[model samples]
Target: MPDSVSPPRTIIVTGGAGFIGSALVRHLVAHTAHEVVTLDKLTYAGDERALAEVAAHPRHHFERVDICDGEALRAAFVRREPDAVFHLAAESHVDRSIEAPAEFVQTNIAGTATLLDVIREWIDGPYAAARSDFRLVHVSTDEVYGSLPLESETRFDEGTAYDPHSPYAASKAASDHLVRAWAHTYGLPAILTHSTNNYGPWQYPEKLIPVVVLRALAGESIPVYGEGANVRDWMHVDDHVRALVAVLERGRLGRTYDIGARGELTNLSVVRDICWLLNELVPAGSGGSYERLITFVDDRPGHDLRYATDPGRAERELGWRAEIPWDEGLRATVQWFVDHRAWSVERLRRR
Candidate 1:
C-alpha cells in the first residue's frame, strides 16, 4: 500500500509457490495491475493451494520450473518476457540445511547464480529496450548477519557484515553476494532485502508458530529447542509482503533494505504465548493449561542467540513501516491455525 502505482507490466516471480512467495503473488494479483508469471518447482513446501485465490485470475500464470534448471529458466524468461524479476526461490529451512547442506548449497547458491545469469542475458539482449526500467528484487534473511548478543541494544543495519553460522544462512549469504555482484559487475538494476522471521496463515508447519499451535491443539508435548531462549524479530507475513512491494517499486537499485516489525520474542516465550491463546480460545478439559506439556529439547548446532534488524532505512527510503502489532498478529495466526486444522495436520505429517 506504500505507493506501488506502477503501470501494468509482466513481472516474473520465482519461487512464487512457497510461503512468502505465495503471499506476495496473492497481494499483487489482488491489489496491483501488474501481470505475474510464477515460476516454481512445486517442492513439498511449495503448494499450489497457497495460491488458490489467484490461480484462476487472468493475469496470474504459473510455470513449473526450478531456478537451477538453466534451460527451463531460460525458456520461462523468453516466454514470459518480463519487465522485471522478483527472485524469491531458495531452500529456506535451517534444520533441513543442517541435515543436508548439499541441497541448500545447490538450490540457494547455485540456483541464484543461474537465475542471475539469465537476468543478465535478458537485460542485454531480448529486453534491451527496457533495460533501464528493469528491476530484480533479491529477497533474503537477517540470519546472514549471524547472531547478536541477547542483551545487545544494537540492531542489524544495511552495513552489517555477513557472518552466517548455519548452512542455510551461509547459502543465502552466498546468494546475496551473487545478486550484488550481478548488479555491480554486470550493471543489472537490482536491490537486496533482509527480513526478520515471518509467521502468518498458510505458513508451513516446519516453522515455529504453526508447529506450536498444532502441537498444542493436539495435546502433544511442545518441543522447545535448547532453553528456548533464542530470540527473533517477528514480522507478520502481510507486513513483510507490503514492505517487499514497496522496496521493489521505490527502492534504489544496488542498495539493501532491512525489513522488520520490532516484534522480538524468545522461543520459549512465543510458545507460552501460543499456549495461553489456545487455552483461552479452546480450553482443555479439567481446567489444565497447555504449558504443562512444554518440553525442552537439545539445542540446534550454531543456533543464533538473537536476530533483530533496524528498519529505519526502509522506513525512510521507501516510506514503509510494519503496521501489524505483535500481539494482534499472533492471535490472528493462532486462530488461523485452529480454523485450518486439516492443512496444519497435513503439513505436520509431511514434516
Candidate 2:
C-alpha cells in the first residue's frame, strides 16, 4: 500500500509461477509500478495458469530457469539487473516431501545457497554501488518450529526455536540458517518471513482446501487424516502477499517477521465447513449432502499437531495486518473453486 513502490524498478520473484509466488506476482503487477521478472523451473506444481491474470502485462516477464542452477541465476541477474529479489521457490508440499526428501533438500537448501552466492557476487560486482539499497526477502514457513501441543495456547514467534520434524520443515530451516549466515558474514541485505498455512484461489489441487472442494463437488470421498484433529492457522493468500511486499519495502535488515491472520481451524472443522459451503453452493443431490462424503484416513508420518504464529511484529512494524476474517476468506476461497470447477478437476487429474 506504500506509494513509493510505483517507481518502476525491476524486481526478481523466484517461483513466481507457483501458488504463493504467482499471488505475489499478481499483487506486484496490479498494485505497484515495479516490473516483475518471474524465475521458475516450471516444476509439476509450478503452473503458468496461476499467473494468467498478469500473463499479458507489459511489466511482467517470465523466465524458465530453476533456482538450483547457479549459472542460470547469474544470467538472470545480468539480464534483469534486478533491484531486489523475493525468494519463494521451494518444494512446498509436506506430504510430497515425506515421500521424496531429496527434492526438498536440493530445491529448498541447495537452491537457496546458490541464490545467495549469486546475490553476493552481484552486490560485489555490478550492483556494488546500490548494495546498500538492495534487499532479498526469503519467504519461509512456520513448520520450522515443529508442532505445538494441541492443548497449548502458545504460538510461534520470532524467537521460536527450530525443531523441524519433517523433511520439508528441515529443508526450510536450513534455508533460513543460510540466509542468516549470508546476512552476517557477507553483509547481505535480507529479510526473512515465516508464515502459517495459506489458502486461496489458484492454489494447486493437491492442497487441502482444493482437495476438499474438488472432492465434494465431484461426489468423491473427502479424505481427512488422523481424525482430523491437527490445527493450522490459515491466512488468505492476498493478505500474505501484502505482508511480503510490506516487509520488502519497510522491514529492517536481518529481521524475521512472522505473518498470520489468527484464523485457526482444525482439519476436520475445515473439511466440514467446506462441505457445508459446497452443499449450499453446488448441491449434492436430492435429500443428500456433501458432508456424508467425509472420510477419515490414516495420518501421514510425522504430521504436526498444531501450527500457529503471532503476526504482532509484522503488524506493528510493517504496518500490515490481515483484513479478511476466517469465514469470509473461506467463503471466497470455496466460491472460487466452485466457479472454476473445470480447472480444479483438471489439476486434480494431473496430480
Candidate 3:
C-alpha cells in the first residue's frame, strides 16, 4: 500500500469532554495535525476542565450536543462535515447503569443508532463528495464479552462471543451491533474496538482506583465489592488513546480490534495497591495506614468475575502497543488523584 498525503482534516469526537474522550481529544490536538471537534452533551460525567488546554486551541472546537438528539446531531454533522467520527459518548459507569438501565439503553444503544443514522446520511449525501476516506471509529468495552472465570486463562479477542452480563455491557453490545449493521447494510465505513479498563489522570473518581484514593484520603471507608476477587486488565488512558489513533488511521473498515495492556489484577489487589500508594503519597493524616479503611461490601448484581483482552490483531495490524507499565502508570495515577484531591472531592460532592 502506498501512502498518499492529504490536507489536515477535521474530526469529531463525541463525549470529547469525558475521561477517555478528552484524552483522545488532547492527543489529537497535541500530537496530530488535524482539526478536532468535541461533541458532547456535558452530562454529569463530562468535565470541560478536562480539556482546558485544547478547549480554545485554534485546531479544536467544542459542541454542546447530545447524540440522541437527532436534529442537533445532524446539524453538527452538516456543519463540521468531519472526515472521521470517534463515537465514545455513552453511559459508562456500571453502577449507574444498574440503577438506571433505561438511561444506558437510551444513551448507549439509542444514541448510537441515532449517531449512525446521521453518519449514514452524511456519508451518502454530503460526505461522498467531501472526502473519499471517511471513517467511523466505534469505541467499545471488553465488558461486552462478559466474564471469564478468575481461574481461567481465556481472554476476549475479536472473535469472542458477546456475553454481556450487566445492563451497561448489554447496552454497549447493542451499540456495537448497530455499528456493524450500519456498515454492512447501509455501506457505512466503521471500525470497532473493545478495550480493557482504563485508568489515568483526569479520570472521574467514580471508578475503583480513584474511589479508593479519594475515600482513603477522606478517611472514609473504601468499599470493595464482595471479596474484590473480580479481575480486570487495566490499561493506561494514554495507551488506549494511542491505540484509538492507530485504529482510526490504519485499521480496516468493519474489523473489530481488541485493545489492552495485559495488566490484569484482582479488584482487591488493585484497591490495596492504591491504598499503599496513597499511604506513601499522602500520609499527613492522623491514620496509621489507608488499608485500614478498606471495607468489604456485597457484590454487585450481574457482576462479571473477570475481563481481559488479547491485542494480537491490533499489534500485528496497526503496530500499536501499550507503552505504560502498570507500576509506573499506577503510581502516577495515584499521585494525580492525590494532587487533585480537591477536584475529585468536588466531583463526588456534585454527583
Identify the candidate with maximal lDDT: 2
The lDDT, on a scale of 0 to 1, for candidate 2 is 0.92
Error of 2 at 247 (Å): 0.2
Q: How well does candidate 2 match the true structure in TM-score terms?
A: 0.97
In candidate 2, position 247 carries an lDDT of: 91
Which 10 consecutive residues of model 3 have the lowest summed lDDT?
1-10
- The deviation in Å at residue 211 for candidate 2 is 0.4
- Per-residue alpha-carbon lDDT of candidate 1 for residues 2-67, written as tens digits (9 for 90 to 100): 435988889988889999999999999988989999999988788899999999999999999999
Return the top candidate by TM-score. Answer: 1
Candidate 2 runs further than 4 Å off: 1-6
List lDDT for all candidates, in order: 0.91, 0.92, 0.91
Q: Order the candidates by lDDT, highest first — what do you get?
A: 2, 1, 3
Candidate 1 TM-score, C-alpha based: 0.98
TM-scores for all candidates?
0.98, 0.97, 0.97
Model 1: lDDT to the true structure? 0.91
